[model samples]
Target: MSRSPSIPDRPHRDIDSDLPDDERLEALRGHYEDLVDVNDQLSEQLDDAEDRRERLREKVDRVERENETLKSSSLYIATVEDVLDDQVIVKQHGNNQEVLTDVSSRIGDRIEPGDRVAVNDSFAIQTILNTETDARAQSMEITAKPAVTYADIGGIDEQVREVREAVEQPLAEPELFDEVGIDPPSGVLLYGPPGTGKTMLAKAVANETDATFIKMAGSELVRKFIGEGSRLVRDLFEMARERQPAIIFIDEIDAIASRRTESKTSGDAEVQRTMMQLLSEMDGFEARGEVRIIAATNRFDMLDRAILRPGRFDRLIEVPEPDRDGREQILQIHTRTMNVADGVDFADLADDTDGYSGAEIESLATEAGMFAIRNDRNEVSHQDFTEALEKIEKDDSSDVISSAGYFYQ
Candidate 1:
């Protein structure tokens, strides 16, 4: 019975036990074959994918490098197709290739085809660039050059005659001075009470002369910083030289030409320095017919005696208040276009308003016409004129006058 039990236990295959060596070897060989096939396919797929990724990366890097190059360049590239007298036409180059863009470059400057260049920053063979731009930008610069013609300004016959002889004639005929063996006057000073057409007279001279007008105030020439004012003066003269036939009009000459004080305050010293520079510039030996100066001042007595010297201001013209005849003419000039009433007498008006400057007369006429318009009247009446006089008197009592008082004066 014991022997039979042992045999029964061994009957079926021992499923829980390790396989035989031959069978184990065969199974392992089949698994190795499958692994090789899978490895080969995976390696091929990996090579293809890596090659595609590398190509994409190279493309992206190239794009980035190009973008960086474009961003870093300070130059603006453009194509030059046409060159006009004063203007040059150009197009910007951009994109992956040459493409038309809105960028432009100035003439007499250099730029590359399809290259970016700064319009303001570039090389010009003719680049002896004008340095006058900076000097001309001074805030207080007053140019003698004016836009008003002699015809444009009205009612200053005596003043105009003086200006013509002093400024306009000299500018128009440089040879006249040479022929007469007389050196041209260095400057002319216009002095008058405020609002007497002094400025207008200067404008007429500027318009008459073919000169560059450099207008400035005397006070503007003084600066807190040392040497700055002097440098500005030198630059201004240099500009006048480069651009010949220049007129320098200084408004309020008393500011720079004030009577020198013995005090040593910083402001006083600055003003003195500015005045010295102005005097030197005005009467400097190098001043020729190419440059002329005109200065205006309401306070002529406030100016230093040295500034009034012959060489500095060869002539000092007085622009006085307009007399009755002058006022009548001035009023007529300003009111020629207005719808005047039949009884409006300019002579009566002139007789009524005395000691009024040309400007005041014009203002009075304008005010009278405006009053008429505001009252819904087509014509300026004697009542309107009287009211205008009263209103002006109320505004500035000193300017208005009674008819009897005016005639008596």
Candidate 2:
């Protein structure tokens, strides 16, 4: 052991008694001042020593913890298979070894089957672990509701009504369905061309309802490994069940629900398995409770016939391109906040945008605003819209030509 350094003695001063009374008094005052200075120095040293002692104590405690950890046996992850009186059967994860372990009284009441736990080499339960949810599934949950509402969406009134009836009405007014002695729609499938407000409709539903919104794409469900995709699908549905009155929006669902083929490739087989799991979850033997499913697909023809059956998707709604009226409505909605000149007529703009979808109409409005900005104008004129229309047509034609060339080559 290292010896601590000794503290130096306090300073001392002796006053001579032979001096005159005033001189003696002055000398005594000086001696008293010196003692006070020494006392202050000692107190400062003691304070510094205490600080050092605290730091050393903390260091020692950390080392002790490390030493204890090193001496402890490694704990392996396990799943509780069954729980008996005071013993529980656990299956070790990596080795698939099942063993009966005694549970302490502290955690005996809490130990249950299907729970994850940590076990030692002797199969003694150390601690119970939380049920693991797929991180990918957790990320798919929409914590913040979208700002979109029914008013924000244009040209999809009928589709919106159907979605609300299928998803929203059941959650909001279940008594009506019960009184009518009819089961509400389990799922709604929206099929339409790309950029026709299919996704926006889902957003509107999410915003309108106070239920949990979990949005995911079909391509994301197709994992690279065997069983991984199916596991993720099961986990997602389980999570939705936990958060009741939840709406699951699966976009571009054709990626996994495509028609099955005779091909025996592993990749294709895995996808088929995942789709089967999704089908089971959609309209399984067990009730889906308060959960509702909404899926959208651009390639509706590619979807499997089994998935489109009555029970899975009670309503197969087609969200087609907006008509002249819808186009005009969409234009007005998109440009509601823009600075439009008095001469700019949305009806004329709608007529010009002939076969455009709602999304295209919105894009046209944005492009017109950009054109006005380019000309250093605050208000958008009819001429700006005309120019924007021409530019979009030209770009579309160029894209068509490029695609044709690529196919021909």
Candidate 3:
């Protein structure tokens, strides 16, 4: 800012020297106030210019950072497949193409098989990356224990015992296996008809043990693209290892362990790849510490022989429909809280339901209650039980007839 002339250097020359002394003094005071006002205006302009400079500096810094990011080289994800004396095999993700790259001594000391790493476009290892766990897999971990205990699961007592032996005993007393001079079973495979208490059995085991329970369905493992399924399996096992003494229950395992064929279909190939990864993780050379696997399936015939082998599933528990006695116990359990007349007998009800599953028995009790409500009665009578059984039987027969028309198994 330019300063306009306000007071002359020689005040006497600007004012009249012949004037009285008081008048001269007052004129000088006016000049002094004018200089002070000009100084204040210049200071305000200086502060505004500094503020503008600071904002521009900040904008320049952000642009510089963006430019640096654009100039940086890109990296791709890969994994170390094998390690040798000097050369290591690295497999690029998505493509599964393996390359033998020479690792520097410093990097080779840190790299190991199964470790995720970053590679350049030339497929050379650049840096080791941390293992990433899937959020879905982590969510499967049960924070609160399930409410279903062994006592709550009626019928199928034998199957429950076998599962407990396979899953619980190992975590409770591992030395029992060592004393017997046997490697504890790696997993237990449960096959049964639907609604036969297979899933309930798994929940019971989760309730009994203090281990982390991670439950995921096999259909969730099937992905739309290649390599994703295998990656998910890897992450799941990695999570189990992170939280030791964990139980991984995979329901409807037939979705992934189905019989592998030589067909060239992409879907089949991807599923097979996922199965191979599962097989490797189950009985691989790496030790499986304190982790137990329990898988259930409705279609045992659909499972691949490789997965059903002795090493993978040491114990194959078959959960069949509850026998007469089991059905009676299941009825007593479901009807424990129901208001039933004294004449209603569980033994007779069990006998009447010859092929009904445990689930069906529970449903029968519920339907019996609904019948009482419909009749505007407070207590369920024997007639209500008989009607529920007849209704369920009719529905079952109709379903069989409808299914038989179009499908042959």
Candidate 4:
């Protein structure tokens, strides 16, 4: 509902002597004013056009530079193998081809053995590349401690001790091993069924120790492309070495460390290659300075023998299901902060829950509290624990029956 713009009145001037002199002067002045307004508008439009042209010029320049880069000869990554008098031995990354190249005087003094550098088609050193660690691996280094502590865990006191001795103590007091005239244990491997507190133990170690804790899963090392997985492993270890007093925890380690197979599929081959790289990083020619290793797996039997040798994994700790006494201790630990009735007995509850892991016992305690909450009670009673246990037992039986049915079918 905008109104139509009125047409501008056409300028009129007559030279008749009958017309008033002041009116004629005013008419001329109006025409002059109209021209001035149009000139101002044109000037504004010219300024805008010039600005647009400048922006387009800049955009074109950037694109042209990018095009030049794309059309240029691609450079290859090479490592300095040796530093001779005038020339250096450079080895290409992918094909491992070695060549002797004369370094530019500008870069000759700076170049050294084991430095990564870029090479042109003529094998001339162009620029130095950083020893690249995978960005994902770099992000996995934990600076903040986990809330878990050894006191919070239950039913695996011996396993906790062994882990502390193998990982935490060595990193904290390396002089102990040296003074005793014994090479420190290299690493510890924790194996058990699900919900047996293997991962929690690692978390406890991270919480108690001052070392840089890096945690990763074995499945993360399996990559979609060739050599990518292996590269990631190398970068992870390099990151650990760079940050000494470091602890590396690999969870579900069977994904990469599984037994090497004869099958020649590309995917399987890549996994094995990644595993070999991990093995080399763990027990290569060079010594690991102050890094400690902790790994957890449910299927210990599937891991390759090379990875489980004495130098690689010095201690193999098994975290089993909680026994009767352990169940009581775990139950007590979980329920300490909860509001429970005075008549509740942890020993009686533990006797009822046979073959339950520490995690399951914790869950039972939580479920009992939830039941009391549901019933509008302030404190949990024995009946709540009984109901929770029955529910969990039913679920377990149902799972077993379904699994058996599937196998038969």
Give the alpha carbon lDDT tens digit for every residue of 211-259 in model 4: 6777877776664323356666776787677876677888878888888
The residue-by-residue lDDT of candidate 3 on 221-311, one tens digit each, is 7743344577677667877778767777888888889887678776777788888888998877222358788888877877887987766
Worst 10 residues of 4 by lDDT: 400-409
Q: How far out, in Å, is residue 324 in model 2?
A: 0.7
Name the best candidate (by lDDT): 2
For model 3, name the residue pairs that clash: none
Model 4, residue pairs in steric clash: none
C-alpha lDDT (0 to 100) for residue 82 of candidate 2: 97
Model 1, 1-409: lDDT tens per residue?
1121111111222222287888767767766766676667667667767777798899999999975865575543334434444444443322112232233344234433322223322321112213343333644445545676766456578789988888877778878887887876778888877677877887777777767777776666664223245545656676677766777777887876788777877667667767788778776644346777788887776778898788888798887777888888888877878888888888888888887777777788889988999999989987788789888888965634322133211
Off by over 4 Å in 3: 1-143, 223-227, 285-288, 397-409
Q: Against the true structure, what is each candidate's TM-score? A: 0.61, 0.65, 0.64, 0.65
Over 4 Å off in model 1, which ranges? 1-145, 152-155, 223-228, 285-288, 397-409
Q: What is the number of backbone collisions in each predicted candidate, taken in the order shown? A: 18, 0, 0, 0
Model 4 local distance difference test score: 0.76
At residue 268, candidate 3 shows an lDDT of 75
The 10 consecutive residues of candidate 1 with the worst lDDT sum are 1-10
